[model samples]
Target: MLRLGSPRRRINIGLIGMTFVLSIFAGRLIQMQGLDTKVYETAAANQRTQIEEIPAQRGSITDVNGHELAVTVEAREVAIDPSKVPAAVRQKIAAILGRQLGKSEQEMAAKLAKDRTRYQLLARDVDPVVATRLLQAGVPALSTKKTYRRLYPAGDLAGSLIGFVGDEGNGLGGMEQAKNTLLAGRDGKQRVETGRDGQQIPMTSSQRTEPVNGQDVRLTIDRDIQWAAQRSIAEQVRKSGAESGTVIVMDVQTAQVVAMANAPELNLNDWRRAPAASYVNKAAADVFEPGSTNKVITAAAALEAKAVTPDTVYQVPDNIRCADQVLRDAHAHKVESMTFRQAMAQSSNVATVMAAREIGSQRLHTMLKAFGFGSAPGGGVPGAEAGLLPDYKKWSGSQNCTVAYGQGVSVTALQMASVYQTIANGGVKIEPQIVAGTTDTSGRYVPAAAGKRTKVVSETTAKEIATMLESAVGVEGTGQLAAIPGYRVAGKTGTANRYDAELGRYEGYTASFVGFAPADQPRLVVLSVLQKPKNGHFGGQLAAPVFKDVMTFAIKSRKIPPTGSAAPQVRMRAGQ
Candidate 1:
């Protein structure tokens, strides 16, 4: 059926036609496939195989006993690729996205209308219910993807301590910020080859890197004890009408921080409503003049120097003068000369000043430093403050008297707790710790090192001090409010008036109490500081009760077996 051209004419015509057609085809192919490949191929990949980040699930945070503190949950993020959408459906796409995201359609449309950006985030951390609804609708240009979102299982139980993450999964405070690098995992990429009809090229996948999941962190906190301490403090804060309160508990044996609770906590899951102060860990941050609590150091120094004995009786006096300073007790009674034990039991400021004066500045400074004064607790967290303690050479005539009763120096709640813990642990002052351990991918834990210990006082001296503390908590002492029903308590009450610099005088007072319970065998050490309490200003009336409540709750929560014993008595040296 083919028609053959005239021999001469057909050859020339056919050759010319074939040359023109071949040249046209080659030019069209190069233009459509080479220079334009990037744009077109990207478009094709968008439909069939997206260039996306595959996020690994962040690890969990647990308490020392494997109690869950913070965990991760799957969340959905909705996005829109506006350029791929048909212009006619723009209004519909905007309406659907905006309503689902709690935004205005006009605002969403304006964002999607941008030509420069290929992808626009419509909503992040969307609830699964909304994500399901959006996905079911399947509006053009809209897409939903899965992501790992942090969640607090304990609510506000340990909120401030555990901390929370931000929208970009970055930590902002607490342990979240401290362990961010370990919590956030590495991301990965994939470039899958696609077939002609927008179908993924199966079995020809390209995955360049694998995601490395974050490590798990465990804290030294005991959840039950933490809950108990927090609840007790909250109850007391409400009942007493104090401005604010803080309580910290450390183990007598290990010196590990069992619980640190502050009132007005921020929710670990929802920190937006939290006040700035709510994020502050007051136990380790706020410093206050440590009233009569400082007397213990003075007493210990005198004991170490053999300056006085439990029965080394002193003459009775209504008041005493340390150079220009006049020292007196809360209640005045000119009794016949009382023994040193009786003087400590009555919490006589004059007696404490005398003890400090006898010990001298050098011995006092050594004892204070040994008690972890003028130093950081070194918990490895940011914002730790080292409280103030003047050196030995800095002591003047009145310095010994004022510092003896906790007036001249300042200390944080943590530092004060360490002071009490030292006495409880047989004079071995252990550094306080917050973090317990961090575990790698294999779930094997690497425990944090136990804090260093320093032997500050002798066991006999520690026992003597414990005996005096016991008398202080018994029938006729200032710390009577700190006694637990079933066990003996050893504690000191502090009532230091806040010094006003502008007015050059003391105005209000800060009430605090630091002590250990079950005096025979120490189970817990509790430090309670109530700032500017409106109802009453005495440490005995305010802070002592708070310490009692916290200590009782902590002991019960830890299920410490009650030794069920009577208080111990200190033996005075013969013929002192």
Candidate 2:
């Protein structure tokens, strides 16, 4: 039916077709091995290579004595390669993980059931010991990653001051937040090739970058003093049934805050469970009417301006009228001629107002500013507030007189303590400092600059006021309970009406006592404050005792010997 092709022709055509197909295959091989080699190789390398982050260790936070307060310790991240785990053992592995990691069995089971994935994170920040036990269980595909966890060795000691870190290893508050940049070092990276089984190929070419650990922060806080302050404040707060309390102790010469304690302190190890209020460093952050404690400022202004002497007589009455307001003394008494020292010792509102008139409002306001009021105390403390102080020109007639006796104004405990520190240090006001210095990654110590000092009053004025303050702690004075055995104490007691911002009205009282020990040669200043105490509300009764206890411990701990000089005689009444 048809002519058949020659056998040679058929063979030649078959060979030609085979050769064309073979040529295509050869070209593809050449392209992959040469022209497009890098593209293909990169694709393969990306699949087999993994880049892991190397966490840099956070720096340590230590007390002045090198006591470790906050530190970073070795930890692990537990994970699983679901693809390597057998289906039968998935449930068993989930059971072990749940028991150790505190996760629900159902949750771990769901994670382990992901057979298509190579990695599933189980838990992070696991203790190394616990992670080792997990790996020892012999579960396939379970692995532990090297990591770090923040540890607070001192527990809640100086918790609010040292602050805490977040899950991302960043500081959130306190000195930790203020100096976070120095505390968080640079992280590094590592790249290594792995086999299909997700195991690192030994001896393979890999790149690694070394991490730079954070710098250590050394604070000026004395650990023993901080502990004592916390203990005393916490005990008194509970005993007095107060809403809150704060205590601050400062080195008079250096203005270094040895101890700053607040009641209901936040525990650094368990910060997440604490209330929001506990996170506040109340000593520096909270502001309130300083009451009679503010009288010291008035006294400083009057004495400095030469408006009144310690023996200047004032006919103090039970009540006095200024503008549209009538101000009364804390106690009811008939008109009496009293020396300026006696009026101050008795905390007579009438006498203070009468004395304030001698200097007028302008001189008084100037003295307040000079004493560091209406300004933030810069000591590297986070959330340190500048208490409110209105201008003297804006003062109403009543405010003029009220402000003279520690009303119509607000101040932080730290600022008030600084005022006394100025007097204690012979009129030189030094900025309060909490951070002593920082230790760098290279292990070199870098000290912070000394606090800025400004002279507020002459040494003569300071000494004279110091003697008057001593008389206030005498038997007839309101601050009698503030006296320590074998030590001449000088301080003022305050009981101001609390102004509740929420209610927009005045309610309750802020009882406080601020003073320094060894009146003739003050070395340390201690201030104790309580807000709205339900049990007792007098500064002498509630706050003064706390001051005496804390000061006693601080002086003894620092080995500050009392000055041998006896207290000079201060006339309370006009006639001796």
Candidate 3:
């Protein structure tokens, strides 16, 4: 607006403008390269670096003989970078992956349309072979991450005992849940520079932390013995049309559970389809009134207290009144005088109750507690219930007499088994064990610490009770069906009225048999229990045969020979 300048004047103005522009450039360069150099460098590195998780392998669960129960197999997880996928080939890539991943083409297309998303999961736990094949197809933007999936090779053989895993690779129940920390290893991490093709740059500096694989868990259960026990119980449950059943076999010397099986079991591989009730390890968790099978406790109590000798005699009645209640025997019979051995062999509730009265409530309670009642069995079994045994102070006169013959008190199957195991082990009540040990990274097994031992009765008292138990399984007793050929089997049959909470009264019956073989020198104790049998409710009729079948198998499996002599005969009637 001023006026046209001369050529020299115009040149001076242009030089000043150029100097101002150069000044701005110099200032900006200094601010970026000198002041915020680290900021720029970090930004560049972030674009070229990627951090990834390195998963560690979970441990395996094996049986006593090293048979695999639960194991982890190599697998892969497929993912997609939707934004990186080329638009022209999105449909084709989606179609190819959809077929292999069991997804619909429409679903895949919809996922790929999320262009703003950097990554999307296509499939998890894909078979490694299938993942490899998919990768070879050259599907754009498709990627794979290594992973593992748990598999149970034994199906549901010991399903409830072995337990299953959750989607995130955590143990959910049974031995798996109990030993999760030892079985789940630590995860690792890696950070490295990536090239434009999303591949790690060779010879580049990187950081990595190695993972620790989990140790193996070895159980004391023998697979073959477990199978035998399972088959026997299942067959009996089906034949008797019982609601359900449980069987437990334990080694007398170690008190280690050789077989713990429950009927209505689910295939562990398909645990998702199992009913909620089937998930419970009944042998360890469920409790019931042990019925006359608990008479052994009374017998042992009386003998140990010196209240009565094996030859002590009592005038038994079909029904006896005790504190506003009349307790009756399983069958009505005329009053008869009988020896302690005869009362036990015939399973006379009246005689047993009379003997218990002699022992007194407090002494009887002490014996029960010493035999591992009213407490958890401490077998390292998760969810093992401490069976219900009311405090002696709360015991009414009726309750005291009822408890003498295995009523009013509750016990888990494992606890009942331990009661017999105590006698079989010569009065030393060893804490039961399920998990034998755990393996190291190098597959060397470190045996578990020994179990605690408590003396429940004198060795002599135990032998005396064992002799009476032997007579109970002889030719003239209620538990005769529990006898094995050529073996002096010792056991008791229990038929207890099942308590129904809704009805607020005892309804139905729980048939059970608990015993050990070769009474002279026991090796194994087997307990079989059936709930609510439709065919027959008596323990001798419904449960004893199952015990015999399972006990025979256990005896043969362990290669235990028979006792050379027959069980000593006992008086079956009064004044014999």
For all candidates, what are the clash counts?
Answer: 0, 0, 0
Residue-level lDDT tens digits of model 3 in 372-484: 88999996987899999999999987998999999999999999999999998899999999999998778788999878998989999999989888878877678989989
The total number of steric clashes, by the backbone 3 Å criterion, in model 1 comes to 0
lDDT of 2 by residue, 369-442 (tens): 99998999897877899998999999988999999888899999999999999999999999999999998768
Per-candidate TM-score against the hidden true structure: 0.84, 0.95, 0.93
Model 3: lowest-lDDT 10 consecutive positions: 566-575
RMSD of each: 5.9, 2.1, 2.5
Candidate 3 structure lDDT = 0.90
Model 2, residue 451: what's the lDDT?
97
Model 2 residue runs over 4 Å out of place are 2-22, 102-107, 113-118
Model 1, TM vs. native: 0.84
- For model 1, residues 1-576, the per-residue Cα lDDT tens digits are 998768888789989999999989988888769878888877865666646677877878888898989898888998877777777878888888889889999998898788466688887888888988987887765667788788888888767777788887887878888788887877776666665433458786576667788888888889888887788777777877776778888888888888888776667767887787788777777777888887888888899899987777777576778779777877787754667777777788877777777878788888888898889978654356788888868776777677888887888888999888899888888888888888877778999888888899999889888888887787767889998898888998888887655578877788888899788899789988877677788888888888888788877777877788876545332244
Worst 10 residues of 1 by lDDT: 567-576
Q: Using lDDT as the measure, which candidate wins? A: 2
Assess each prediction's global lDDT (C-alpha) against the native: 0.80, 0.91, 0.90
Model 3 spans with C-alpha error above 4 angstroms: 1-25, 83-98, 102-116, 195-198, 501-505
